[model samples]
Target: SIPDELQLQILELCDMTTLAAICRTNKEWYAKASPIIWSDIDFVELSGDGAYDDGLIDQQRQFFATCSTRMDERPDFWAALAARVQSLKLTRMPGIAISYKSKAELNDSNDYIFIEIWPRDRRNIYDVIAEFKNLHTLYLFVKDWWEFSSIGESEKAVAHNLEKLTNLKVGGQINQDMMLALLSRPENIQHLSLINLIHSPGQDNGPNPVLFLRSIQKRFTNLKTLHMSKLAELTEDTNITGARWEFDPAAEIDLLEEWADFLRHVSATL
Candidate 1:
């Protein structure tokens, strides 16, 4: 047998099927190879109308459900396996993905697309987060399709000790609730990306998006990189003034002016 480190180095390059076979060879091999296989995972679904030719969606859902169940039944074992996960990516399909564009303008969709993020049960969402204590990079988008979020960021379940999290990217309308919650608790984050921070429509006077962005910049000043997709969303761009890029601005004129002020402040801060 090769040295454990060298064995793991070779095993790291092997695909899942090959690793599965090698793992079955013996308990020792399985023990050595297990963590490498579960370290980085992409929870994705089939493209288009979510018609899984391979039932991939359900398979992943079952896998997630099984993992969540293990957390409840075998806390130590589940934690050990889940802690091995250092990088996690969640992607929803295009049409149903996170979007600030309308179908009429984008000309991409003729109908609405429904998506799901935690199919097992809403509680599984938090339960799953609690498992990955060592997560370093977390990208979440379109896990579930909900216009209005039922989850809150301030909830006790969301307070998972994410001391290791450094990178966060939000591309779609996946978990607006989670995004909002995470923003409320910005910790040790170095990289941040927000494509479209969708939330329940806000009033003109308060809870402004510009103000929201300012608060985020101030809270995450340690951010080495910050990405905001629709720059026009926070400012007055004469070129795309009427572009209506994904932001509803509530058609409030004062909101637009405040957004322009927010843009100036953000530019100066950066």
Candidate 2:
């Protein structure tokens, strides 16, 4: 048998798949390999049959069910699972409506994934973020801007624990008020990546996205790295939301300038 230290070193060198396989062999292996595997949670888009069910993402429902079960039945393990997660990212959204079965309780759902898409089943990820207590990084990879607004509950829960977060990445259309709220929450955000942001221009009668872009300096004063993108003029309907709006080139330039000024500030701080 390999010594535990050497086993750990070997596991660290292996890729996630290999370590995950090793973790399943036994508790000894799990104790050795699970930590490294859980260190950085990266989720890519999953497809195939279970990607959609009856025009809904049924898989997400199962994930919520599982979390509910764990929270209720396996509190100790659930807590341990939460504490182990340091980095979290969900890279793709199922291109359909999220079907909520309020009639069915979270712990009582019967649609066990039988298995497609690794843990797209884990989309019920709110409590993991809210109660985790030690998350260092979070990435919400929303394909559509609208989806960001839908996860308000998760966002609010995360807000309570933002003091410990050091890195964050969010892509999608987020509400301007919440954007301001979250950006200010992190006390020492080291890296920030913002992608495909959207704003409701007509509602305010003034440019939107730029409003949040300009506020970054005040909200994230201690940021060390920042990336902002996707403000080109929208000439056609969006594939994700099927909504189109006027994109202001001039506003884009101003946001870019704000980002630059913040970068300069970051450089000065260094």
Candidate 3:
């Protein structure tokens, strides 16, 4: 028989399908392969119009349900598997379409259902995340603004406790409080990316650009790579001129100065 260490090394090179096959072969191999299979969980490629396939919806729902629990009541095998996860990626999907309801009625129904179910689902998801004490990387992409806001609200506490995190990428709308929570372990983070960010309408809802830059400059001393796209403060016009929003010349000058100062501070480290 091959040595256990060598077998594990072999399993590490295997893909998910191979790992699954190995797990079904015998108990010893299952023990060795399952952790590797579950270590880097990804749901980012789950994309569709939400009506293309009912099976897809069912599969997604099953995954969420399974992750909702940290397997406290389940067997130790599952708990052990959950603990092995080091990276995770999730993306929000479109709602199911129902033909029985009118457009307005369907939207109203879905809104009510989503409002009720999402919080519970989010809580469960975070509960599992909390179980991942060894988690190092996380990526989340949410297309819906409301869902993004809801996720931000739920992410504060769980994300604050992720001491081992080093890389994080988020694509959605983020508020000031959420940003603060995400940056709680800034000392450990080396890579940060914020993409496709949507601007909140009010000043209170969105992060202040000056303050954000200052935080990046001061807190994230270990940051090596920073990428942000579609950021609101950098692109939004502060002034409304007759029926259109126009960029204020004064604000542009001030923003440029702030960026210059921030860059100067982080130039040595970045």
Candidate 4:
């Protein structure tokens, strides 16, 4: 009883799962809607059992693998899902290892509830990062910082590819090198929310890069909001007069002059 044009429109909005349900209505509908429905998939909540499933994730990877061959684009299937996915909330990792799936329960008030965490294999994230090019906002509920230390050690960090990202909220001591690696990329990141930034001393003889104690404010021109705690070092001065400012005097440095110059630079620019 459906018109051809209207039927096609409906098919465009449905996924493989819903298409299967629609197709059961009639044979003619099945023939017309099958291709569009099969094009992309949503697999975040695959199990009705309400627990993490390693086998299910593997099955999804395999399904995408086969779908990629047919589509002639290795990332087409994942890309489609990524584009559709607005937000993903990663909980603890699956069993037999550290879980990334959230211990928190979902509420109807929250728009973000479910996200896929890294597999038990620490290295699997390299591929995960490569897959989600359209991901703009990421929430990481990580238990271990080491789970992500190697992320940027390669050619570049995942931030390079996620050009659309505007906000990032994370927990843990994200390494300074990794942060710098991301900031170096020419992208306009507006907001960075972090907690527990446990900074270790850097090899640089001067001020450490992580502390933001030096003249590196120029690096984060687009940064607007910063949520953190206990960041300032005692070496940094609160004196607005700029006269009491001191650097390492053993190296024969004029602290006041250098502070004045930096102050002038900041004033002139803003």
Specify the highest-lDDT model's number: 2
**Each candidate's lDDT (Cα)?**
0.53, 0.56, 0.56, 0.43
Which residue pairs of candidate 3 clash?
Answer: none
lDDT of 2: 0.56
* Tens-place lDDT digits, model 1, residues 155-266: 3444555567788877644343455455555647677777644443223322223224444544554556667654234443244223233355463444456446544645
TM-score of each: 0.63, 0.67, 0.63, 0.42
RMSD from true fold, candidate 4 = 13.0
Model 2, runs deviating above 4 Å: 44-65, 94-127, 145-153, 199-210, 213-216, 219-221, 232-242, 249-267
Model 4 ranges with Cα > 4 A deviation: 1-75, 91-122, 145-157, 185-187, 199-216, 230-270
Using TM-score as the measure, name the better of candidate 1 and candidate 4: 1
lDDT of 4 by residue, 1-270 (tens): 888989899788764557768878888776787555443343543544636564544444344334334334545655564455333333322211222333342222322212233443443332343345555555543323123334443326464566666666554334555455434432355666654333332223322213321344444456556554322333533332221212234321333343345344344323
**RMSD of each predicted structure:** 8.9, 7.3, 7.5, 13.0
Winner by lDDT between candidate 2 and candidate 1:
2
Q: Judging by lDDT, tell me the better candidate of 1 and 4.
A: 1
Residue 65 of model 2 has an lDDT of 51
